[model samples]
Target: MTFKPLLQHFKEMKHYFIVVVLVFGVSFYLGWANSEQFSHFLKDQLEGLKSLSQSLSNKDNPQMWFFFIIFLNNAVKSVAIIFLGLPLGILPLFMLVANGMILGYVLSLQTHESTLSIVLKGILPHGIIEIPVILLACAYGLKLGMLVWKSAAQIFVPVANRTASAELKKVLTLTKPLIVIIVVLLLLAAIIESTLTYWLVHL
Candidate 1:
């Protein structure tokens, strides 16, 4: 499928993208500035990830395992958020906030390396593709959430079915193409994270 449809979806749903960005930005700042308040929760998350990492490391061809794990985790979650948004968009928002905060919290933590070093060596390599792709998925998810409300309103107001159907078509039409885009980019990102970023951080 052509990437143009996904780009078109972005154009139509720019507002949702803006809202996602704003929410993510504010949450990131909160996570960075008030990390202590979130430490109890964030630490648990980190611990779980660390456990997973250690287990994966023991496996033969750890890098290959990492690639599969990372790509599947991200891809499945990304797709889930799109449909999970059907319930007033709560899950996608939560995912956006949690992911954003996790990033910010990690960046804010003190370490032997400089902040720039951590960013350059740890995040930028994979995150450049991973971040935007995730955000794009969330924006569509948010749009779907908004449509859910509108659909509910129509039950009472009784507007033309065509208008409602078209609005839905506009969003649903992007699903396949968007999933393809997310999966493809995230695969590349997984490769980078597993190989390049892993190598850099270890060194």
Candidate 2:
């Protein structure tokens, strides 16, 4: 299969990448500002998850529901802009950064030496596909936001009115497939991560 679309997908996601980084920068600042509080929060969450996972090991447990919830929560945070319309850019970016930081901090809390192993084993399978898929979905939102901003600008500039129709059509066409493709890829990635990757890691 061609990696070109995947590469182009990354290229298109570049804008969101910058936005995500900036959001993380802000999170890092917050983290830096209140290190103790943040640290405590991370520790508590980690311990809570571990306990929850352990409890769910039994056949009768309902904690398995958490897996789906967590999965959807992760997916929604990345694609939240879709429903929010043009206003999604800032919030999605913020969510992305906060997610990365939270992930980084959580891994750190788990084990320093095994950090790399844990991340690779736990995240790589689904993350490789899922993260990009999420980014692409958000890109569609960004494209919409750009269109709206451009449309609003047309009120002041005659040139803005010149090609709005054509440009808007192109944007809509480009983004529609992006939403579908991303969702498909994400599901495939999640499957690989949950099954094959899980087995390999244990091996």
Candidate 3:
């Protein structure tokens, strides 16, 4: 799409972006503070994925599988946030909190220096793009939830029906571009994560 529309989209979604960031920050801090607890929680959750993770990790040329897995995971999450926002936006917020807490809990296990090094060498390469895409998806998801609320609240008012219809149309129009951007960024992130991130951490 054109730069103007993209820029406009960013401006419109700025507030939601900030909200997502704040939510993430608070959850991250909580996770860090209760690292031991979250650690146990995460471990239990991860237990089911251990075999899958191990299998992926053992590949001699894991990049293909890594990219496929990461891309699929991100795509599913983005779709969930966007579509599931109709349920009062709770799903999108849950995603932000869950990811933030896991990230914080995992980081807390590392030494300060190691954490810094990891952030710089491992996360930054792909995270720069991936994080924003995630936040944008969440912001749009929250926006969708707001739209649903607005439509529901004005359901009884005849005049409000037209307004609600317009709003729904607007949301649908905006979501198309958002989904496209998210897909592109996630693809890039998958590539970098499979290559640059892998090499950096292994080094």
Candidate 4:
């Protein structure tokens, strides 16, 4: 894929980006706004990761906890996605923002050097695809929530007159494909992250 195309795609998903930014921004502001705190957190996480990586270097299988780790990670992601995708109007978005904040906070805790290593070892292996896939699902959830919001606005319409058949059809038409794509991507990531990544790291 052309770099330009990816950029354009991201450009079109400005809302998703914005939500992530707002969430991460608030997180950084609260947890690492101070230079000292940021630096300390960064150093700590880096050192911790470095130690862990070094320890794994001699392991016959570094991914001894592979299934457990991936399961935990997926569980967190799924729960967050579901909670944030709920059709409770903007509540899901708020949850999304909060999720972003927590991620940012954790990331900020890593030192740049360690962060780079972590990116390569912990993230890049599968995160290249996983992150985007999750974000797309989030966007779909956001879009779904928006539809529900619109439907809610018409709640006062007499029940007989307010047949939401058209709206339901519209949502399903747009959402079905999105759901399929997201699920496929998520599954692909899980496979890569769980199996391939485990072997690669251990090797």
Candidate 5:
């Protein structure tokens, strides 16, 4: 499938992307600043992720299973954020904050030099691709949330069923392709994470 339109769409939503990034950055700073205080809390809140990271790190043959687990986790998370944005986008924003908090907390556990090493070796391989995909998903989710709000506002006015249906169709038409692209990108990211990132970090 052609990704030109999808890329263009993401470019158009630059404001949403910036907002999501800023929110993540703010939360990340908070987590980093209070690393000691937040460490236990983050560990408790992200037990599953901790377990998964441990499993991935400890495994010798982490190829197939690693790919499967990471892919499923990311796919579910991305889909959840996008769909849950239906509630005026609050859920997506929360998801972004949660992610930033987790990242910052985890990174803060290391010394500055170690943190740089970890990011360069452990995260950057797949992160280069994965991060942008996530931002795009968040942007689309926010857009969907705004659409939901607009549709809700339309309820107060008299709108024809046919017109609403057409509008919905237009939305679906735009959303479906974007979802496909996100899924594809996530799949590639999972592959890179399981293979290249796994190797680099272990080395």
Candidate 6:
């Protein structure tokens, strides 16, 4: 069997990826510009994160703990969005917007710090890979959502002829393998974030 590069196939759905980026960007801007409006929401979220961090901060192996936490968190959420997106893609969109907004809100709170410095010193090291992986997951999730919508339409109205099955067949060819790829990439990102990013941020 002749194998085609996944990149080439991914291009077939560039529109989904583009939409993901745009939605994330807009949500991020809103989070940054109107952070005051979301202060309570952000605080509640951060408290939960802080609790999780405290629970997981095993002194015996800090780096390993970081890796385990980051990887597991990203991997589970990333994979969940894809399948969870089946409901008209709402969950994926919500996740992306929420995640982006959370990031922006956090950065906005760091007003006394140089944002560029913080991003370069902290985020850029791993975000280069991590952020893209997440966006890609959200993109796939959005596509799955659309497919479900089409499927329903076809079921209720035969003339609607959405061909969701045929569309999904193409996607399925990549979905399983693609998830493995996402996991591997997120693993790499986790490693970088745990070690390299930690060093960079501390240094």
TM-score for model 5?
0.85
Model 6, global lDDT:
0.85
CA displacement after TM-score superposition, residue 203 of candidate 2 (Å): 7.3
Model 3, 1-203: lDDT tens digits are 44456567677778898999999899889888898767777776556556676799898767788889988999788867887887778889998988788778767878987999978887899989888788778887888888788787777665624576576677777677777778988998999988999789889
Tens-digit per-residue lDDT, 1-203, candidate 5: 56576667666678898998898899899788887777777888779876877787677876878898988888888867887787888988887878788888878888987999999987888888887777767776787787777777778877665354455455556777777877888899999988888788878
Task: Rank the models by TM-score, top first.
Answer: 1, 6, 3, 5, 2, 4
The sequence of per-residue lDDT tens digits that candidate 6 reaches over residues 1-203 is 22365567787788998999999999898789899998788779888988877776656777789899899999999988888887899999998888888888878977665888888888998999999999999998889889878877788886745679788777756777778888999999999999998888778
List, residue by residue over 127-149, the lDDT tens digit for candidate 4: 77876665555664565566566
lDDT (Cα atoms) of all candidates against the true structure: 0.88, 0.59, 0.81, 0.57, 0.79, 0.85
Better of 3 and 6 by TM-score: 6
TM-scores, all candidates, are: 0.94, 0.65, 0.89, 0.58, 0.85, 0.91
In the order shown, what is each candidate's alpha-carbon RMSD? 1.6, 5.0, 2.2, 7.3, 2.9, 2.0
- lDDT, model 1: 0.88
Best by lDDT: 1
Clashing pairs in 3: none
Q: Candidate 2 regions off by >4 Å?
A: 1-80, 83-85, 160-166, 197-203
In model 4, which runs have C-alpha deviations exceeding 4 angstroms? 1-86, 157-165, 199-203
Instruction: Kindly indicate the candidate among 4 and 6 with the higher lDDT.
Output: 6
